[model samples]
Target chain A: MPSILGFGACLPPRVVTHEELAERLGVEPGWILEACGIRERRWAQEETVVDLAEGAAREALSAGGLRPGDLGAIILGTGTPQRQFPGVSAELQRRLGCPGIPAFDVHLASSGGMVALCLARELCRAYGPVLAVGAERMSDIVQRDFVKETAILFGDGAGAAVVSPAEGPLEILEALWAADGDFASDLCLDSGGPLKMNGRTVIMQANRKLVATVETLLARAGRRTGEVDLFVFHQANLNLLRQVARTLGVEASKVPITLHRYGNTSAASVLIAAAEAWKEGRFHFGSLGLLAAFGAGFSWGGMLVEAR
Target chain B: MNTLDDIRALVAALAQAPLPEDPEASLFEAGVIDSFGVMDLVAQLEARFALKVPDEDMLPRKFESLSKIAAYVASRKA
Candidate 1:
C-alpha cells in the first residue's frame, strides 16, 4: 500500500475576516460566524492557482527530502483551473521540472483532493512516488453581489502530499468514493457564471452522503470509528462538520477543522487539513486517520490511513 | 414526547428562534429555520425520539411548523 511521505499547504497572504465581509455585505458580523462558522479566510490578491500549487508541491517535496526529478507522477486536483486547455497539472509539472512522468488534473470539486489521493495510491503501485496537489482560487469566480453564501464560504489556497510505496508514517489503508448525479444541480458554477448553490439541499445531501459513505468505508475496512485517531473532513462548513461528527459518534476534538482559517478551498480542503494536522504532530506512529469530503457533484468519498 | 407543546418547545430550542403560535405558519418563509437549521432539527429529532428520519423524510413539508413536525414525529414513531 502507498503511504504519505510528506504533506504541505500554502495560503494566500491576504486574510479576509468575516467582520470585513459582513460589513461589506450589510449583515451582522456574528451572522457569518453563526451560519458558516467561518471567522476568516484567505484570498489571493495576485497569485495564480498554479503558483499556490507549485509552492505547496515544493514544500511537500522538500519535507519528503525529494526533488522534482524524483517524483514519478503529478496529480493536480482543482475545480477552479486558470484555463480549460492544458490542465493545471501539466503546467505544474513543467514548473516543477518533472517533464517525463504522467501528469493530469481531476475535478471532483471539493472532493477532488481526496479522490486524487486515492488515484495516487493506485499509481504508486506501479510508479514509485506520486505527488498529489489540490489548488483552488475560488475568489476568482465567486460573486460577492449575487451569491452571498458561496461568496463568504470560499477562499484561495493549495495543499500537497507526497505519496510513495516506501514505509512511512501514514499508510493508505482503504479508499471509497461515490456520487449521486440527481443532486448535481444542488451546487454548481457554470463557466462564465458565478457559483450557485442550494445551501439547504447541499447541506442535507452532504450530511447524509458523507455519513453513509464513511460508515460503508469503515465497514468494508472492518475498522471501528473509535479507532480513528484523526478525522479530516473537507472544510466546507464548520457546523456541518460538527453535526456529521456528532452523527457519527466521533468526538468533536478528533476532527481537524480549517474552515475558520481558510474557508472552503474546495479541492484543497481535506489535504490542507491533513497537512496542517501533520505539521502539528497530530498523528503518531500506528495512529489511524480518516479523510472524507462532499462536493458540488454531490460527490463524496472517504480514505482510511494508518500512521506507521 | 407526544404533546404539541413539547414539540413546539423542542423546535424553538433547536431553531434558536421563536416560532409563531400559529401552527400553520411557514417556518421556512418566516425565517425560523434555514437549511442548516433543518439538519440540526432532524438530528435533534432523531436523538430525542431515537428514530432515524430517512433522507426522503427531510422534505420542507414534513417540517413546515411545530404542528407538522409533531405530526411527522408521531407518524415516524408509529
Candidate 2:
C-alpha cells in the first residue's frame, strides 16, 4: 500500500472576516454565521493558484525528507486552474525544478483532492514517490453581488501530500468513487460567469450520496463505521458536516473540520483539513481514518485509510 | 405509527438547538433550520414516513415550521 509520508498546507495571509464580508455585501454578520458556520476565510490576494500549490508542495517535500527531483510525478487537483492551455501540474513541475517528471491535473470539482490521492496511489506502484496537491483560488471567480451564497462560502488555499511505498503512520487501504449527472447543473460555474448553486438541491443530494458512499466504502473494507477513528469530510459547510456525522452516528469530535476558519476551499478543503490535523498530532499508529468528499459533477467518493 | 409529536421531537433533535415553541414560526427566519438542516429533515421524514417527497414539494413553505412539516407528512401518509 502507498503510505502518506508527509502532509502540508498553505493558506494565504489575508483573512476576510464575516463582518467584513457582511459589510461589503450589506448583510448582517450574524446571518453569515448562521447560514454557514464560517467565521473567516483566507484570500489569495496576490498569489495565484500555482504560487499556493508550490508553497504547499515544498513544505510536503521538506517534511517527507525528499527533494523535488526525488518525486516521480505531480498530480494537481484543482477546479480553479491557473491557465486553460497547460495543466497546473506541468507548471508546478517546472516551478519545483523537476521539469521532466510526469504531471497532470484532475478536475473533479471539490472531490478533486481525494481523486488525486487515489491516482497518486496507482502512480506509486510504478514510481518512487508522487506528490498530490489540491489548490484553489476561489476568490478569483466568485461574484459577490451575483452569487452571494457561494461568494461567502469559498476561500483560497492549497494542500499537498507525499505518497510513496514506505513505512508511515497513514497507509492507503481502499478508495471508491461515484458520480451522478442528474444533479450536475445544481452546482456549476459557466464561462465568464460567477459560481451559481441551488443550495437546497446540492445539500440534499450531497448528504444522501455522501452517507451512502461512506457506508459502502466501510462495508467493502470489512470495517464498521464505529471502528473508524477519524472522519475527514469535504469542508463544504459546517452544517452539512454536522448533519452527515449525526446521520452516520459518528461523534462530532471525531470529524476534523476546517470550514469555520478556511470556509470552503473547494478541491483543497479535505487535504487542508487532513494536513492540519496531522500537524496537530491527531493521527497515531493503528488509527483508522476515512476521507470523503462531494462536489459539482455530482461527484463523490470515500477512501479508507489506516495508520501503520 | 409515528405521530405528530414524534415528528416534532425529531425536528428538535435534528435542529440540535432549541426551536421556538410556536409551530407556525418560520424555522428559516428563526435560524432553527438552514438549507442543510432541511436536507436532513427531508431524509428523516422519508425514512420515518416511507414516502418520497417530490422535488416540487421541497419548498420553504412546506418545511417552514414544525406544524407544517408534520402536516405535510400526514398528508403524504393519507
Best by lDDT: 1
Each prediction's total of clashing residue pairs, residues at least 3 apart in sequence or on different chains, is 1, 0
Tens-place lDDT per residue, model 1, A1-308, is 67889899999999999998898888898888877888899999889999999999999988788899999999999999999979999999999997889999997779899888888888987887999999999988875344566677888999999999877778888888777787777788887877778777777888888888788878888999999889999999887888889889999999988998899999999989999999999888889888888897878888888888
lDDT of 2 by residue, A1-308 (tens): 67888889999999999999899888899999988889999999889899999999998888788899999999999999978858888889989998777899998769898788878888887887999999999998775343567668989999999999766668888888777787778788776776778776677777777888889888888999999999999999887898899889999999998999999999888889989888887777788989889998878877888988
What candidate 1 gets wrong by more than 4 Å, as runs, is A143-147, B1-15, B20-24, B43-52, B55-62, B65-78
Query: What's model 1's lDDT at A15?
Result: 98
RMSD of 2: 4.3
Please give the distance, in angstroms, between residue A110's alpha carbon in candidate 1 and its true position after superposition: 1.1
The runs of at least 3 residues in candidate 2 whose Cα sits more than 4 Å from the true structure, single-residue gaps closed, are: A143-147, B1-34, B50-78
Instruction: Name the candidate that leads on TM-score.
Output: 1
